[model samples]
Target: MTALSELNDDIVRSMSVGAVFSDFGGKVNSLDFHRTADLLVTSSDDDSVRFYDTTSAKLVKTTYHKKHGADRICFTHHPSSVVCSSKHNLDNSGEFLRYLSMYDNRCLRYFKGHKERVVSLSMSPVNDSFMSGSLDHSVRIWDLRVNACQGILHLRGRPTVAYDQQGLVFAVAMEGGAIKLFDSRSYDKGPFDTFLVGGDTAEVCDIKFSNDGRSMLLTTTNNNVYLLDAYNGEKKGGFSMDSSQNATIEATFTPDGQYVCSGSGDGNIHVWNINNEPTKVACLDSYIGVPTCLKWAPRRVMFAAASSVLTFWIPNDAKPGLESGGLNSEV
Candidate 1:
């Protein structure tokens, strides 16, 4: 067999289940892992945010937001702090964005501004500041210490936002395949660089930057995932999904930036070797339902994907070498 095919075979052989969380009663809408901990936070249609200890696969804490159901959940810089966007209160007295202390499920702050449902949320790598994108055609920046938006970018269509690893720059993807990059220090000055993705592809559902801050991934509703040079906006490659499925497939880059993993409506997880020629490396099947959220651990040989269940994939007998940096955590 060719060398590429052999590499694919080896990867498929090494990857296996490291942990499984099957307690989610409804579909998992979003998931985020702590940067340096063995913990995972998940928001589900069950109107709760659950935390799992990756090593033990135990649900450590569950925070239920009943009236304004939880949707996009993410852990801020603090291990005990979480930010999520949910529906308004049944009494029409609250906001869609909330910051909570996960330890006791105490609501610490509420960011109110978006008139429509918030579609996306991302935490900055360096601070308590975070960004939220909404179907209201705006992307707002909020600080955990405040209850109001620090800044807002009004767009023509749905907006998806991401911050670089250093929190030095941020990218915003909006309608008509437009990507605008702004400096975190002075975002109000407008984009310093802009890139336009051309093709039949349209709406961008999610945007993420590689851990190294050198590359970007844009997953669109058109069943296409585009990999771009994060700095210059040059297109590096693109991965195609089965358009027949018509689901919002979330794709993520491994911490090493060598591969990309995504979920399919076919109830399977797909991995691609992007460091070489960007080919389909493997497909893991037999999932109970469509896995909508996929995230790679920041410093481990493992990654996690969620459907109604949370599954962690790790390379068997994998050792951290000179390249992988080191083990992420004790987990």
Candidate 2:
């Protein structure tokens, strides 16, 4: 394995396949690698959430939902149950995630409320509350402790949500290209701040906060990624992927906040350095399907990339010195 000290700012050596986890017949919709454990969870259109043991690359368990299929899946902060989104099985016309299902021994409990399909979901860092963003142009905070919806916040456009590392604050990237920040403690109140980026034409697809909570990253359908000052909502720096015809779906920060990984509809995963002098660190060329999600697993020394399949990459330990030109010195 590559030691943390040996890694330079701009290059990421692709690790060998430590183990292959699953060979799902259908496409993988979304996935999440656990922050503190060796486990990883994946959701697919096949209507299941499969768990894998990263250390052995073995399938530990497979939990199936009775609904049509899952659009997204994530583990709760408490580590006991999983939160998943699904659409109607027969007709895909009405996409509404009225229920947030928790899987335990193949049994499920639905947390229902929203009138539209849930597009994105996240759990609070400070409490057991979880939030879901939907095609209905609204976000609802759910308290798993009581299995009830706590508060609902409306947006001008469809929004994607993520919690900061501390869980005290959360960010929502609206489809109209604005980001709203809110405190988890004040759910019924309005947002504490709003950062406007593009006008009505640009759609914000994803938003993430840095590990230190000092910076925020925003990705738009226009192929632009912006880094903003977390506290002041000032633009720090941004890069455009205008050369490609594909839409950038999601962007995420590496654990150290040195690199940002973006998944695109053109079936490519691009990694970028965020230390002022931005550089494209690595591009994984194997995914033929659109790369929909990316997650960093810091402790396991692995990162999860989801396209049609869920793939895990570790640091290429055998070939340590290989260099990729995309890493910036400041990374």
Candidate 3:
């Protein structure tokens, strides 16, 4: 295993641009990058919302979530709206965020309706509409045009959601190995299709739509990942990680859709080539613990992974560490 010092030096030197804001002594649960201002918005167990400059790596602002700790945070595609959720107890004994809180100049407006804690939140890739998934087993769509709940579709179980590129279709992965699709135009009535995953019976942990919205990726608690056809809900291919001792937490497609990167419970990030035959491209072995989250930057040719600490990875243009070739050569 490489030492932390060596990993830090390699990342710092190879990183064309990055940031390290470690003021929060707690784990960062979620992170989102604002495209317009090039600001990074991060939420952690420390109950703080931090904004950092993506260019100069400077701390811009810090705001508390009104004494309530945040679990997940996301920015609407619009530059004006921000949404955040409170941490939820595993035993369901404590108060969680029942509504999505929109922030503007430190003033917050709650979009209340769900009876349970909000587990996942995402913004439409093509519009100002946003979607939220709750433990109440429902997905709700919110439109900023009216600041009200435009539609709600109940699922068989709690789900994680992602929107397609056109903002017309949304995918929700339920707890019982099922993924449902709903059209924003017809979301008020019902889902268009409910697709069942094969192989592992573990609950779906995360889901993401490909860059072109032609495919979707699903990660489960059983170290298995599946790529599905976005149109008809047919399985294109699937892969399982032998090194993943624990569940796969999240999987995401690179900007070009040639690779899929995932964070596992074994304190490592795995990259897979999805262009031809799917294979393990690289394994990022720098993280110290289970990576709670991962985010790919929009413009930069880099990505960030978060556990107890936030780590950035840029292409090793000189000498690549893994057998997958240098990041620059591949990306």
Candidate 4:
């Protein structure tokens, strides 16, 4: 097996676009990587889902969701299944999250509850339990093993949700830069801790915890990304760039937690070298315009971004240690 994530300053700076897949007829809305697999998957406005083998930067399969229309998607704890939110409905299904089996093309289960669109969906890191935040002003928790929602929270404004590395707790980001933390086992009890992101007044776009559970990253529609202490909510630092209307630019952390990267309205990939004392941010041009959705591979030194096209980033090995990066086939 490949060595556990070789991400570093040299590898990140030497990185360039490795491969591009323009397979979507519409914009790629969401993408995710399997927890322990080299596989990456995306959901698109074209009403389809596509999976890629990150090892080769190659397409593995494509499935259509014409009836419901796929949007925010996430891989469940199982390898061959995923939970997807949909914008279109054939009957009175409401805005339901569909649990699908990729290999057999079967709807393993349908989780129903949200009255409005589900804006954020996250699969648990350790089990079948998952959670969703909806525009209807509520957050619901569900388990793949059960057909019904296990818990729900009614809150004001749009919300986004994420599970920490250990899955022992989860965080919810609200409209006023307020973040609430809850224990997964007893989430009905309410958030044990709440922290305000000092200056960002824009609605929270997405929230994520670093692999070490030490830091948190939050983004806003106003084109700002902030890194904070996951435990104390102390602001570490953040940066902003050109604005994109109504777009949530996601910021992701490398597996080693040394850096964070995000896409911007100006069609550039912004990399923040946070490990440095001064926190330097670099910009690299992107072929996929408005590359709003981006993610770093959970277990590899590679990263992927998308719009209507999906582009993979890998180290430009001519300087040194290129082949050892593991995603060389695309280069």
- Best candidate, TM-score: 4
Estimate, for each residue in 1-331, the C-alpha lDDT of model 3 and write its tens digit.
1222233323433432123344676878788877555667778878777775554455567777654567777877654456777664423433343233334445344566677778788888777688888888878787655546788877777778888867888888886688878887777667789888866667676788876787898877676779888888788778775434432366677666767777766666777767666767567764446666777666555667776566556655523422233222210
For all predictions, the C-alpha RMSD in Å is 5.2, 6.0, 7.3, 2.7
Q: How many backbone clashes does candidate 2 have?
A: 4
Compared with the true structure, what per-residue lDDT tens digits does model 4 show for residues 43-85? 9999998888877667888999998899999998777789999
lDDT of each: 0.80, 0.68, 0.66, 0.83
Q: Residue 64 lDDT in model 2?
A: 66
On the 0 to 100 scale, the lDDT of residue 299 in model 3 is: 57
Give the poorly placed runs of model 2, Cα more than 4 Å off.
3-6, 14-22, 66-68, 89-108, 242-248, 318-331
Give Cα distance to truth, residue 9, candidate 2, Å: 3.6
| Cα displacement (Å) at residue 254, model 2 | 0.8
lDDT of 1 by residue, 69-174 (tens): 8889899878888998986472375488989899878889888888888888989888888999998899999999988789999998999999998999999999
Q: Of the pair 1 and 3, which is ahead by lDDT?
A: 1
Going through the candidates in order, what is the number of backbone clashes in each?
0, 4, 0, 0
Relative to the true structure, candidate 1 reaches a TM of 0.90
lDDT of 2 at 273: 71
Query: Is candidate 1 or 3 superior in TM-score?
Result: 1
